[model samples]
Target: MKRDLGRGGIVVHPYRGYGSRQEVFVMGRVFRQAALGRAIPHHGVLRDVADVVRRIARHGVAGVRVEASLGANRTTATTDRDGFFDIHLPLQTPLPQGLSWHQAELQVSQGDDRMHCHAEVYIPPPETDLLVISDIDDTVMYTGVADRLRMLYRLFVQKAHQRTAFPGVAALYRALHVGADGEARRPILYVSRGPWSIYEMLEAFFQLNCIPVGPILFLREWGLSWRRPWPRRAEDHKHDLITRMLTMMEDLPCVLIGDSGQHDPEVYTRIVKEHPGRVKAIYIRRVDRRPDRERAIERLREEIAHSDCELVLAADSAAMAAHAHAKGLIAQHDLVEVHQACVDEG
Candidate 1:
């Protein structure tokens, strides 16, 4: 899908890479300004329409060179027609997993297209006790992702700094990262159905609100084009991604977090059933007000009865924190901090 060479200029779109002490994996895309979009003034519904139009006009540049560098080690690959590239490099000297986040540079080059950018490659510490995998939309923030029009309004209308997170989410995540004894940097990974286009905005949202920094994995590129559905559905993508994360670290068990506004309950329930004893707990924020939705969650509770996994449909972060504390997922002091954070938000 070779796109036209544009005066819009080429930009490097490197996602936050992930790896361990042995090697590092890097992934990114190179596209015109129209693809990732320029920081232009946009307002309301019309702005949403403009975003879609830009994506439809975007294709990709083939055979662009990409170089990924970490410390003295460097690796290279070329972008496909979709302008995407991924490279796995074995290190002569492996990085210590004690380092929470490792900095890596990605340099993109073609005939006239040349750009250099930085990507944060994440490596979970060796002492990580419990892994936390969470969703971004309604689970962390106030976005109505299950509702498309409302999701559009919040996404396109608000700036990154202006977007609001659910109360006490940052504190809850931090507590999970710094385990029960408060000495561990338990790995916390954030997953989203959203495209790679909003990576900067999402990163800003996390940092601005004091959430724990970890590898943020997005399932695909932007879904703006009306071409086809997506590479895969949301439920399928999330389940597979989480499964890979769990398989990556065999010793550490995970606690999954999401909202009731979407298919989180269904996806997570299946995961818990498939891999018994792998998931510690499932915390889902009760977003939908409908009784049928509530009953749907209750049915999920019955479905997971054969397993020891606890499915909690909580009303707020405070309640969820209390539940996690009682379940020994977090410490008592951590619960207190989460409650205090909620009070501060008010």
Candidate 2:
């Protein structure tokens, strides 16, 4: 079920078979606070409105409550009439070594049909020294939302309702989170520009596709409608977020993975510039063939010219594996590594 946790969030219970296995979506105030009196009308579409209402009805009056076992330890509000709640947890919470894993429990009380859901929040261990910043649209999946033409067509006419993943991106994502040994570990962070509406969709897509779970930070919509186009100055917001995250983990090195479709090159380029010494490398997927996009492409090249961050463009997951092996990102023996490491550990 999906619900708006008022401050600008869309909480998503992304998977089934909970307990020690699943994770829930928890958004931040950057979006929630901004969305306060600025939500666009639902267009009063009966189907869409009904869907939201049904989801809310599933939660009932008790609604949902989230308790993050990290940082200062905070909880969230109950579901509103619009089916929304907001919980603002600090990015870093000082927990004991064994308690590094954050957990959220949802108790839905709608009369006799009550439900209790819980998922482990994959908080990075204190010893974690690796960071993974990723691109959403194509690098993660085959959404192909970066292209203005397809985006226009889908946003206007087709609506391209279903979201799908690229062939092996999920497996690669799993490897990145779990390393050689299989354990419920951390050191992974997913950064994207996808708006609030699809928060649950993105989480569901990743879980269904076998991608490992991680903290997903996305854009705030900033009062824009769902059909609003990507803004011209949007990359700066990502750049700022990256900088803050990097600064928090300044002691560790980060690996940035993105697609050649949008502002990733530019955002990451600025990140490398601001914290050149902290960036380990960068990997970009080749998705578009426009020469005009060369300006953004050049930005990555410019960063590579002066820093230790290696930037490579892959045609697909296979190409990414080959290139990663060649560059020593992972061992050659693990080249065939498929699925998330947690499965192996289980």
Candidate 3:
């Protein structure tokens, strides 16, 4: 029950994980907390550098043994060099009907004490019409991810509640979670290219902004951890993760959301091609205003033409929400909430 192994100087950062019909993945990091919190750097030059140093310093014990059990299934995983452990277990029977997620126990042995905690693993019900997987950077909040200085400033200075979700994203995401009939209660997975160091902060951000939380999946551990795949870090990350979901939940369709500032267009295009009719929609927020970027996304429409997926390049959340409303992907009444949420700065 003690997730933060304070006495043992170890903390397990287990995310609200997700799964399909019979398979559930529960992932978390068991890192060593720094003896004391690092000071916020004063100069701009030190801000970004200091943050990375702090993250790796706090990134705890690697190769630790982990024990996780889901229902009758139990599995063990060793933390990688980055102190991250991802365990996959399969359930023989489907979770109870009408349930969106299930809680499973995970135990980590550190020295004399065996610390443990329960982490939520989402299991989409049979009624789910679509599964939503969204990115968190420029897509969810204004982190200024492309700008290194601004991104470091936001990451170090801003608290989760202080962070803001892109206009109308909360309402738009909520509508998708509830589905078109206003009661389907689908699953929404939040993923990012960033490391697991910000997991707690991201969780608080989701809770504060009212975005439905399913699983927080990340592709790599970022700069400090050179172990991440080189060159293609963002590439095929969304495609690969979604493929796993699609493989497990064969009957359900999927909707992808990300910003044009990154490789979302290309990654999503690959998913649409590889999965065929499983993708319902792809919403890429147009954060990049360059003429070349606009034309680039336009070409993706041609790529996914034959598939049921429609890649919509929109400038704002309102545009995507409008499209979803017109298509009855989200309840019509939810449009007002979407419009209102977009303008709500708080």
Candidate 4:
């Protein structure tokens, strides 16, 4: 569920979190009059530019105290220098059966001012078979990440709805989330190399396109400064996140989805090699046309051939869906919907 800003200037913006039955981890930020409100439908390039500026200019309130409670379990933490608070609350009692989504009450205070909000937590049921982890940039949406200038233009000037998703992606993700039986409620987690400033834009993009909203792990603020000019390597960031997810959910196998652009192939290949049998499949979208890149990915595919995971480089979402159906990751009827979505989106 989405939370609204409180009356005070202070706001607690909580991202979706996932955890096991024994413990729940939730994270959010405390900001002063800098809440990125819901992305409403709007028009004009100037408005889009203004929206991006507003997002970038927002500042966090550092050192604020944050308290989180899930039922009787409670924990407290102070915000980091970036005003981000991460809380790990141990569960005295296991979560109720059959409930996939749970809410945790969050309150942030600095001096006499305080603000309250709810954080959503996702815990996959025991019956879930596969955990889906996907990349956002070129995998799900059309952000020309390989071309820096074009990517920046699209990122800074496009509204949520104006930004387009690849054909049939929504249906494919939906099918993956529901599983073959159409009864399992599997979690679909997304990871991005983008910074936290664009969080609201991505959230609105998921809601607008009907994609399942999961915990989106994003990078921290990056800019040209005296302290640090360059951002961390994208490969390192994504690799760390995937490994953390695998460690957190040790029982469930994972389906890795990414694009040919950048280091997804290398990063995912490393994950497959390091965690053998844990990754069921690796789906790479063919976003780049370079032959050398294709050959490199092919070598990676062959390298992982000994493992149980299959590396699939697909030209379109329909191809991925077909492979998933054959592997029983998605239902047979869902394939039809994916094909129709391709045609409709085209």
Of the candidates shown, which would achieve the greatest TM-score relative to the real structure? 4
Cα lDDT of model 3 by residue, 1-346, tens digit = 2443223367777777778766888888887764333454454655645544555467557878889887777889999887878888877855677677678888888778687888888887777788888888889887877887777667655668778788888889989889788888888877787666777678889888888877888886664536742224456667788788788778688889999998988988888898788888999998899999899899988988877789999878888998888878987789778877767743
Per-model lDDT: 0.79, 0.56, 0.78, 0.83
**Estimated TM-score per prediction?**
0.85, 0.66, 0.88, 0.91
| Residue 85, candidate 3: C-alpha displacement in angstroms | 0.9
Q: Which ten residues in a row are the worst by lDDT in model 3?
A: 1-10
Candidate 2 residues lying further than 4 Å off, grouped into runs, are: 1-94, 104-120, 146-161, 180-184, 225-233, 292-299, 338-346
lDDT (Cα, 0-100) at 275 in candidate 3: 79
Model 1 residue pairs with clashes: none
Measured with C-alpha atoms, the lDDT of residue 298 in candidate 4 is 98
Q: Model 1 segments beyond 4 Å from truth?
A: 1-7, 34-59, 71-74, 112-114, 226-232
**For model 2, what is the C-alpha lDDT against the true structure?**
0.56
In terms of lDDT, which candidate is strongest? 4
Quick one: ranking by TM-score, best first? Answer: 4, 3, 1, 2
For residues 132-151, write the lDDT of model 1, one tens digit per residue.
Answer: 89988899988887677777
Clash totals, every prediction = 0, 9, 3, 0
Candidate 4 backbone collisions, by pair: none
Better model by lDDT: candidate 3 vs candidate 4 = 4
